[model samples]
Target: MQSPAHGRRLDAVTGPFTPRTPRVVAARRLHRRRDRDTAGRFLAEGPQAVREALDRTDTVVELFGTPTALDRHADLAARAARADLPVSEITDEALAALTETVAPQGLVAVCRHLDVPLRTALARGPRLVAVLAGIRDPGNAGTVLRTADAAGAGVVVFAGDTVDPYNGKCVRASAGSLFHVDVVRAADPGAAVAGLRAAGLTILATTGYGDSDLDDLVDHGRLAAPTAWLFGAEAHGLPEELTAVADARVRVPLHGRAESLNLAAAAAVCLYASARALR
Candidate 1:
């Protein structure tokens, strides 16, 4: 098992890679987690993701595009060239292979993995952190990440059985916030929580039947300090064992007669509340 601190790249080694063909047979293999993990890379498709990935220095590995896509978004190729990154002109069939979208965006970029060790994120003295423990849905996880980034959370932890941070759906769902925030993929969520606590972050778990109310926490200024918010699986919510470790279990109040909000909605409410209070 890799420790949290092992997550550092020391220096971002921009690989001197050339996309021999726009098809990038190399990128096609990255659809699987094992392939992505082994290569230390993942795929980001669409103009938005490709654009954002390229905006960050040393993040994009190689870029692939159909002529139509390149022509439609000409600036992307220029950006890639300026960065001295490989740009491959591929066929529609190749774009089909590289992307999972029903309507392929005709653009794909190979990106270096963004996850760092929990220790690295903690060392930064992050005021807001979002922990996705036992979350298996990539879309939900990605949405939460987007929300976290919007709410000023500097770090996001994908712990235990959580979805891969590099999952294609997750990358698109993050809408480029994946590159904006520090990420931690912890095998042991308990250790992740312990490290956060050790770093002086108060852990608050979100559950439907929690003892504390979301508005009340903000009202009391309880969220003004460094804090880690733990969110659980979509179907089962947080486990008893995990929930027991929380300083508090918080629920969003339902004033509109809505039974509940989905994972993403609830997260947005909680994270924003904390964001507002911390300000």
Candidate 2:
């Protein structure tokens, strides 16, 4: 088992792990979100997430873990070593303070945020895409991203007012799929829909009261065209502007009187259905 007393010199490396101090703490918190957008940097924690980041080392800026984490995640540490990443040993207390969760997984990483241009995302040749509009829950946002990836979506776009994709909870909920998918934040919902249409992608918005039943509107044989699936926040369906721009408005047929599906579940159902339809 590795311990903080390992031969690695704590002061010799670059990235955020060089030395543990008040300054590093303050910098991490302040730059967590702002730097995410401007510098294209984000944070990842836990053994699994850190391992994933190490596999894609070009994306990692720094790696930190406690003695136990190093011992428990030897393979990850080996990868980090091969990547020449700055790896540092910190006290459990220090790791806990840097993380947002009550039980810190003893490992965390600073990574370059993925900047997938809207144009590039649209060009991915997706037969289906999922566009989330104003969904505020971080868990829902993450789950939707995971579902999109599972359904082989071309991309996942976040319209105005959606939760931050890098939020700790959202990142964890994504179970590392966040690293595999193209997720973009749009300036506005209307503009996003317009861009999709301009790319020759069909826009289909999901609504409980929609006139067209989803099953009837989607034809497996005719799914060759690029398509974007628009999902609304839980409290309200897609905004009026989005609904108005959609080429088609469709609904999932419900047998029970359940008011509506949770945003994440609905997204999964919609994405899976689209995948099946296209197959």
Candidate 3:
């Protein structure tokens, strides 16, 4: 329904929600990783993230946006309306307070954590998976998740001391792919590797130092089988113990003078290689 005030085409009326508003306060609490973990929810900003979060059933708990943001993205407003989700009109300052970005997207959605148990992800015979083993960068982790989805991977597991997939930067970096693929966070890297192997996935660790070369594996047509690619932080590759558990440690052959590829690029090359071989 259109607001009767000043012939505004918006559905919201009355006062815009502020940072101090109780519900807004609760949503704002998600800004911290600890509170988000405790509440089993995280914040997704921008119209794209909010729209994607809304697409999944029961994924979005509440959506808050500025009047201008809602006005600009009516399709999102309609989607929220169809879900019967409460769309609170929030002030700009409130939105900035809820986000880590200097330029707030003007829209934010409180979403249920997107991760599933590792077994659930490995079940159903996944042909391709990306395991972020001790990945410390949220941006890289998110980028790898996006690349995994694009490369036809069915799941992405965040293992060991990896950053939370729900980190604000990570969620934004995923570009909504967080909702597109199965995500797993395993605190124990060893058990995660074992589970992947038990599920019949060949665990390949991507590292600068490896006995096997990725090109050789592809050339030999060894990439057709179900595979899980393990990626680590760029500065320091996979931990020694984690690397030891891998079925094979494979390095992407650098034909160039450059010594190594960053985490995201390496993951894309490895995942796409398997995707092509599988097809």
Candidate 4:
């Protein structure tokens, strides 16, 4: 008989599933980058991310959880019912074993990769987009994506050899914002920049040694235009060649003793600056 709660028939989850169960084992495989890439699927754990996944079309491949988790997140199950998505109740042990987090939060969602092409995102004529060039930190990259979404940027572009945006840690750090924004993975940084320029967006390269101060740009109304902010890896910042291609080298004016802002912080400051100016 189908369970009225989830509107799907599930096995009587007698106890925790063995770690060797086929479904559990398949989910465990996603812990590896290669497996995720090969499957074209990644895991989104916890209620928040899972909820966001359920809300998006064709994103959630499967939903798994323990009975307690499903009950705790009944709203999500209800939403899934409305969307005609199937939900399964796994054992707590199986849930924990399938995810990297110490606490599995009772639910996990397998979702399709959301990466789009750089040219496609650029073709949208975004008022603001973040171009992350070689940002290697998953936490920082995810935070930037969240910040860009909060700041109303039309999209985010991960250019060059940046960390995979679909990395588990990155997905967790995004805190549901991953579903709220269009994200592009650009294999070619140079070509990505060219596309942005062709779209008529002012490319502002952020660097510690930039020529124009961020405040000056805002005060001068320089940021009151369609723009894409170029941010680089924390260790090296933007390369000289990349900066040379930008319309301006912009820096955040820091008066404190703090040496530098972290990548995520810098991106937030830059993106919000543009958001404020353009308003």
Candidate 5:
């Protein structure tokens, strides 16, 4: 449908938009970190990610989808209507142009960045939390977020030089767990660790050189207390300075000849250990 005044194609039901429109251009720019940061928004693509974003209605700025995609996800459109958010239907060409993925799931949503501060997260008095210290890999970071959410942890902190939690890859890797947990970023890793300690959370640093073993902590019931697990990068592990301040440097015991667990695997083992102990 063409607008009477503007002469632009607009779908009444789906709010059809053109590829070169200002709204579309701005949303496409979210593909860049600088633009996303500037607009305080990021794109959540695919049915699951968009649905999850809509579940947190206040966080979703706008939703875009194709007519066919909206029909398939009728419930999402209905919910969006209930929340008073219109689902903008755009041309397939425009949707394809908006994302970097080879094939999109036909839906995209612009969501307000949902990260909080370390102080706010600490003030919640969270019981089980995962702290990523200087983790650069977005996949590893997102996997940890999902694992933390699954283990019933309270929050996931991307501390220090961690990847942007709102990055498209990280968000997709989280598989909607991004909306399930309280995510935060801390520019200063040491300060974040100190804050956690100050909040009465026993810091358990995962390191190869740790004095305490993870199994011992679980078997001995040491993980029952409110604790924060500090996970470093996949390649280098935790920094010595950060581990030095932790209440306990805990290591996952390996039975086989394997070198060590990857970042995500290590996080799953550690988080579930705490979850079981706390249960």
Candidate 6:
């Protein structure tokens, strides 16, 4: 085991930092999520992702790594050094203790979370946006955000019962696009939809059994002004209330007998198609 001297906690010691008292562990978990809402703090892990976040945002608070990990990510270390970022060197075991994953990648970052207002994201006049309602899977949510970013959507809204965007898996899957796009967490679904409507954004719900096929209903060449594609959970689909408020319900044309597409896949197709239509 390797350890180093640091300002706060001892460098990674032999074991898992004495199990970090149950209360402390619980508090850190809460911090991961609440930090975003309350203090504008978020956690980014893994060398590549942390490096990306550090390069893009000025919100990084602390950078944690082991000697081997730092060697592998010399560029990031150099940047951190130049910025005077608080760096903590610990043993591999200690790094694992602070990480959410079973196999820690030996790097984790505490960064200031972005809380862009919905209106601010819409300011540039985005014609396509993705509104995720009640998406419970972190992987699914991350994929949706990634797709939205790729499709050039202005923002992604997580409305009601959705998985935390800061979840380690989601952050990893997003491939640092999470730093590039606007991600907003809504207090309620109805309010979010209402806000979009007020912004002159048309809400389109994606359903497996909609009467209008996405191919036919959406004229790629003549997309309507400011559109928001609404996707529901994979298992339950969108709630009836949400679907009811949509300006239109669209379904992807499927030639096969497959019941439905995965939520993330469906979101990507919808966002891409919508973006293509606008262009």
Q: Considering every candidate listed, which one attains the maximal lDDT?
A: 3
Candidates ranked by lDDT: 3, 1, 4, 5, 2, 6
Lowest-sum lDDT 10-residue window in model 6: 1-10
Write candidate 6's Cα lDDT for 194-213 as tens digits: 98888888889999987668
- Candidate 1 per-residue lDDT, tens place, 40-111, comes to 999999999998888788889878777677778878877786676767666676778788999988889999
lDDT of each structure? Answer: 0.85, 0.76, 0.86, 0.85, 0.84, 0.75
lDDT of 2 by residue, 71-184 (tens): 687677666766766677766666766677888788888787764878888777767888989888888888888899999986888889987788778888888878878788
For residues 1-279, write the lDDT of model 5, one tens digit per residue.
533222223466545676876788889999888988899999999999988888784888777777778778877766665676656778888798676689897888889998888777777778998998988998888888999999988789888888889888999889999998889878888998888888889999998767898988888889889999999998999988899999999888988998888889889999998898888
Worst 10 residues of 5 by lDDT: 1-10
Worst 10 residues of 4 by lDDT: 8-17
Which residue pairs clash in candidate 4? none
lDDT of model 4, residue 213: 99
Estimate the lDDT of model 4: 0.85
Per-residue CA lDDT of model 4 for 1-279, tens digit only, reads 458855543766534455776777897788888999899888999999998988789998777888888888888877776666767777767887778788778888888998787767766778998988998898888889899999999888888888888888889888888898889988888888888888889999999989999999988999999999999988999988799999999988889999899888888999999999888
Candidate 4 ranges beyond 4 A from true positions: 12-17
Candidate 3 residues 47-132, lDDT tens each?
88998898888999877888888778777866776676777777887888888888877889889998999888777678999989
lDDT of 6: 0.75
Task: Between candidates 1 and 3, name the one with more favorable lDDT.
Answer: 3
Q: Which is the winner by lDDT between candidate 2 and candidate 4?
A: 4
Better of 5 and 6 by lDDT: 5
Local lDDT at 269 for model 2: 79
Model 2 residue runs over 4 Å out of place are 1-23, 30-32, 219-224
